[model samples]
Target: MKPSLQLKLSQHLTLTPQLQQSIRLLQLSTLELNQEIERFLLENPMLERDEPDGGEYASGPTPAAGSAQDGVNGSEQPSEQDNRDAAHEEQQGIDWSDTGSAPGASSTRDRDNDEEVDFQEFQPAETSLREHLDQQIALSQMCDRDRALARLVVEALDDDGYLHQTLEELLALVPAEHGVELEELEIALRQVQSLEPAGIAARSPQECLGLQLRAMPEDPVRKLALTIVEGHLELLAERNFARIKRLTGCDDDALRAAHALICSLDPHPGARHGSDDTRYVLPDVVVRKTRGRWTVGLNAEAMPRLRINQLYASILQQHRGQGGELPAQLQEARWLIKNVQQRFDTILRVAQAIVDQQRQFFDHGAVAMRPLTLREIADQLELHESTVSRVTTQKYMATPRGVFEFKYFFGSHVATDTGGAASSTAIRALIRQLVEAEDGKKPLSDAKIADLLGQQGIVVARRTIAKYRETMSIPPVSQRKTI
Candidate 1:
């Protein structure tokens, strides 16, 4: 084969540094963006908050042609009236009052005049969950290896205090400093269960309930409750009181007592500690209900005060006057500031896009949730689907329905009997509501519910209805049917 070389000219898109920073900031959750800002402040000497040079109103290129009101700038003067009006504007979904304010202060005068700015207080709790468990372990009589293994097991437990991971998996995760086998890990787990919360380290809901029942001081009803949890949880979940009564060979009074005992056990023992310890929700948007109408706004409170560093800008201005040479370092500093500003701009744009798409969710809650997808959002905003996905993933909005993940608005479409479509999420929500309100003595069958939904214009097949029902942990028709 003859070797040939050819040259052709073609254009391809390349991400500029500023564009890349914008994309990166757009993808970060609000908490993550705050952290990124903090890290940038620590590393960049040129970027900072400062008193405005003068109490003068200045004009620049306006915010990107957005739907928000056009006149607001970053440097508005702060006053009681300004605060009240700003709050009112925010509630009305108007753009923030964006006169040239110093990064931390609403205006230059406020920055120059005020010495103290009110900061959000971080109130620390008395004792953390891990600390509470450690204290219990310390007061116990377990040996060092046992304590070590128990610590691994306890740590392996999820926020609900259920050991979702297997003993083998936990054994693998534990360091060799513990030098424990799976059997030893299991044994240590059992000992951890002996702590104050009787079922803290159990592997499943049934197991947790069983452990709690076993720890009771030999009440006859406790044994019956343990029997139900250990072997008849499916029956109990379906509210099959008759089958449970028959199988346990308990009379009505005894079964009632046992059922009462079963009800007392915690389904989620560790839920009290809070679920998202790793990430906090700083809602990027807020939706309010005003006189039966829904109003939405970008949460200005959650946004950090950002402005061009006046001190650095002044220094750059002075250096410009010297007129000898523009330093390479100064150019780099300018690039950084531009990138940060672009980042915030992108975030604001993306936030607006999300609010626009999910406005219905804000108005009517989950039941009225409309179908949305990343591709749809991306197409609307002229951005990539991946960019939309990343923006929505960990982000949250404080809506009239309360705070929800931004991604919650997106759901798969399911065909309805009316030839229209509904979000699968909405159907699931409907099924949950139906199941919650079902009569325990005669629980609704999936097939019956499917028929009922069809009558209401949602055309779900019996099997499809069953699948969604089971996904929600609701059992089969046979399991749900009463005696």
Candidate 2:
């Protein structure tokens, strides 16, 4: 064989600056995206938040396509030129409703307006549980060391107002403070528990319920209530109303009344104090199913409408003739603007491809999510596999079903008995349903679940079933056993 010169025509992907920018932007969380916008506004003299009554000068034709301001020192803006550019842009016309008038908007005018309202009006001062206890402790004339011990115990209480750790475990943390007798500590603990939210600072669910029941105004048949919470907690767990009547020495009528009272008691009194604050997840896409077709749209409201600064672009044009350092800065500015545009374009393309592929999922929910791979999507969109992965990584889409991370539509293929493949996500969902519907007295074990899956033609081992169950936070058969 002899070496011969050969010419081949093929396309390959290189990590271009534009692609890098797009990937970086695609993965930014909401907070990170806001920070990016702020950094851009600070560095670009031609970019400013449009202000109402700043007049026609405040917004300038929304800036032309490719215009972007060059930095003073490669990334810095010259103070004099920056001021002039900002003044010019301030005179530009814009519909205030477009950027302005949005709640929680980042604007100097908005900030100023917000500062005027008394914070106490709509926003109540939140008194944390620990702080509340501290206040009560401060008001008490307890000894210094006792106060310290009380604080430690209160801190140890979980979000549910139940102390998960044993008293001995807590004592170990502050052994030096063991000067206070365990009995005294117990007394202090009981006193703290008696404060507002009756069941708070309880050692267990039974104790929390008992505290609330003890706090109730009526005293008739109180002993029976206590007996039910203390001696017959198992009966309560199993919802054994008949057994509860026998155990509490109460007839059907009394048992019925006691059960109603028990339902009103707070099981996790401290949950509100240390519980998670409600977080709103805004989607990056909205998918709608109409006429048996799935439609997708980018959540435009969540995205910042960006454009190259026109005034800065003109200065860049002037700098090109002048030459020197200014020209370099102008080029840098152009690159930044181009990168921002490219980022949006790539994301839009990737998002559209995802919607097209997961149209079934959008129409019929996650169970209908077909087995999709990053390579397939990349090929469909004429992009590299890695590019597709990056674009889908942190991005999300909103569909008729709900908002889902773009990657949620993709999963590892589980080989089916019929030679076809199913999405692992779908299998996990099925496992969840099976476990939920399982008979409590005989909860399905991992092996039993695997057998069920086999019947569906999806061959998976017991360990694999266990792994999926663990991922769903379902406990093992022993732990799931009912009372």
Candidate 3:
């Protein structure tokens, strides 16, 4: 085949640099956006935080649209009432204050508790599992041999606090010159196991449970729990309560009590002190109920207050285009500022739209959630479906119910008999309710749950119910069965 030059007219789509930046900013989580802004702030001298009322800059980045949300440009000043109203309007949310209150006028209980110490004042947040174990070992009155051996075992422990290495392995780990033996290592292991969290230094899950059960005060339930963990743990896990009952010679009530007691024990006690990889979330918007109407606004705290640097602005105004790269930097800064503002505005608009649609969910919980799709929200907000998708991804909203990703409100639908639809989330909620209310003696199977939903005129297949159940981390009917 021969190739020839052709000049047929063709149409193409191109994204401008500013539009690309807007799209990029919209997709980033609050933390990631702040990081991007920090880079821009460092690279571009003309771009700086606009702090007002002598306040520090917001740690998050949602872009400050005005001079400062709270501060006026130059001429007019807002009244105290106006300032209060503006602050409220900017951070519209339920008056759901944090549970932590300022130490109020001391009550008798408060006065009595005043003498006690608090964790914050005593311990730092960065303390790790290894460090915590080391501290406990230091305070312990073990002999030198025991201490050294215990420290060695502590070092070998997994983050979940299990000593995966057996006594022989641990003994082999010791220095030949130290004269450490298997018996001493065993004693040292016991010493570590007896620490604050009841299940540390265990060789296996069975031992872990046994250790926790032994720590409890002497009681029949505790005795039964110890019996179960010591031998019938596999039986308990398989939900073979009938066999357990026959073997233990315990009635339903006694077995139930024992099961409940065993359930209360922490399987992985050391996990709480493991490497803290907690990801902090800064919600882009907060949904609130004001005057009996659901409302939403930008979370001011999550948005970085950005404004053109006055010094840079004045320099550019006077120097005009003469200041080589300064003009370009100023232009770049302006683009960033505009894009950031647009990013946040888009987030707020999308979040408000979501809150309006999912208001039933807020009032009556997940069961009342209606089926939603990206197209529905896009059409309602007059935005492209892709734009809505970008807005929802990684964006979050703080509501009275809880903080949830923007995407959580959107899900596929299931048809109902009334020629309507039900959200997968709502169906999941219904499934959860049925399971929770189900008799442990004969837990509802996936097929049974589907039939139950069908009875309510909402059609859900058994496999779909099973899928939803698995997603929710619920066990199957066999695993869920109890005495």
Candidate 4:
């Protein structure tokens, strides 16, 4: 085949580094953005956080050079030489504030106040499951070999403290030359299981329950609980009270007591000692009802206040045209700042649009939520549907009804008798209400729930209702029915 160069005319879109950064920042959640800012602060010397009491320098638009007299204490206007310097600085990606305040120009008192405000008290670290087990093992009287084997077994156990691997599988892990006998491994397993949190090192759910049952005080109920765990687990799970009664020969009160005891046992005993790191969701935007109108605003605390490092910019200004890494770093810092600002601006716009569309939800809860879509918000905000999707993915809004993800407001529509569409979220809310108010002895079936919704104007299928019910972790009528 002969190769020939041909000029082909085509049109395509390309994202600049700044545009790519903007897209990335827009998609990131508040936590992720904060982490990204921290990373940039570390990598780029020309970027720094605008501290509070840095005055107007912390926020607002960069002032025009001609308006220098409007700054703090009527600062003197720059001369021709100073203007040249300022222009040079601007060219180097330095964004000077309108107030004309220099970077780190805040008084000592202001700096001290900022230090006090930014100080966060340290929290004590939580001990993990393995750490807790190791502490117990350390305190026990055991030889080196036994301790090592026990440590291996402890390490092999999963987060739930269940040994998913068989003894044979674990035995294979040991070196052949070590000649670790199965009896020694068994002893080690027993030693580890004998530690605190009664059900650790259990091979199965049955064994886990058995361990907890054995730890309980001796009682007739405990004995029956042991029997139930041993052989009648399936019957118990099915709530086949008749079969269980026939097999155990226990009366209503006795069986109930045994069941209650079994319920009290911890199926996952090691869960208590697991990692206790609680993740807190910070809303990116807040929606409020003001003077009979819905208003949306960004969460100030969630946003990282970023600014160009005036000190670095000044240094670059001093060495003009000495092209090196400084200019690249300066450009990068400028891009990051502009991208971050654009990200939040886009988020605020999208959030405001969402609040305006879903005002009914804020006023009357989830049931009042109207059917919304990404395309609707995207069209209203003049943004791409993918951009809207990214903005909604991890972003959250604090509303009168509570915090919710941006995506929570957008749901598929269900046709109604009134020729209007109701949000699937509204339908799910109605389902939840019906289930919550249902009589325990005769829980409402999915079909009954559908019928009730049909009567209320919203049309939904039984399968959809069941799916939403399961999504909300609600059980079926059969499982929900009380004795």
Best by lDDT: 3
Give all candidates' CA lDDT scores: 0.70, 0.71, 0.85, 0.85
TM-score, cand. 2 vs. native: 0.66
Give the best candidate by TM-score.
3
- TM-score, one value per model: 0.63, 0.66, 0.80, 0.78
Task: Please provide, for model 3 over 1-483, each residue's C-alpha lDDT reduced to its tens digit, 9 standing for 90 to 100.
Answer: 899998899899999888888888888888999899999999999888876654543323333334444343555767998689657745875342454322342465577687675756867567677789889989989877788888988999888888888889878877899887788888888899888788888888899989989888999999998998898999999988989999999999999999999899889988988777778888889989999889998888898877666666666778886888988888788888888888888998998889889889999999999989999999999999999999999898999999999989999999999999999999999999999999988889999999999999999889999999999999999998877
Residue-level lDDT of model 4, residues 235-302, one tens digit each, is 88877777888998888788889888888988888888777778899998888888999999888888
Better by lDDT, candidate 4 or 1:
4
- Lowest lDDT 10-residue stretch of candidate 3: 96-105
Expressed as tens digits, the lDDT of each residue in 331-431 for candidate 1 is 44455555545544555566666667666666666676767788887888897888777777777778656788867778888887667888877888888
Please give, for residues 1-483, the per-residue lDDT of candidate 2 as tens digits: 998999999999798765566567766755567688688777766554433332332212344434343122234547997697556656774344676553334576667878897876877567778887789888888888778878888888766677777777776677674565567778778777877778988877888888888887766566677778888887766667666766566886676666667777878787666635777766666776667666666665555554445556567676667644545554444555555556556777877777788776665666666788999888988888987777777677776566778788888988998999888888888898888999876789999999998998989989999998899899888656442
- State the TM-score for model 4: 0.78
Model 1 misplaced regions, further than 4 Å: 1-8, 50-195, 199-211, 214-220, 226-243, 266-278, 289-293, 320-360, 375-387, 470-483
Better of 1 and 2 by TM-score: 2
TM-score of 1: 0.63
What are the candidates' C-alpha RMSDs?
Answer: 12.1, 10.2, 10.5, 10.0
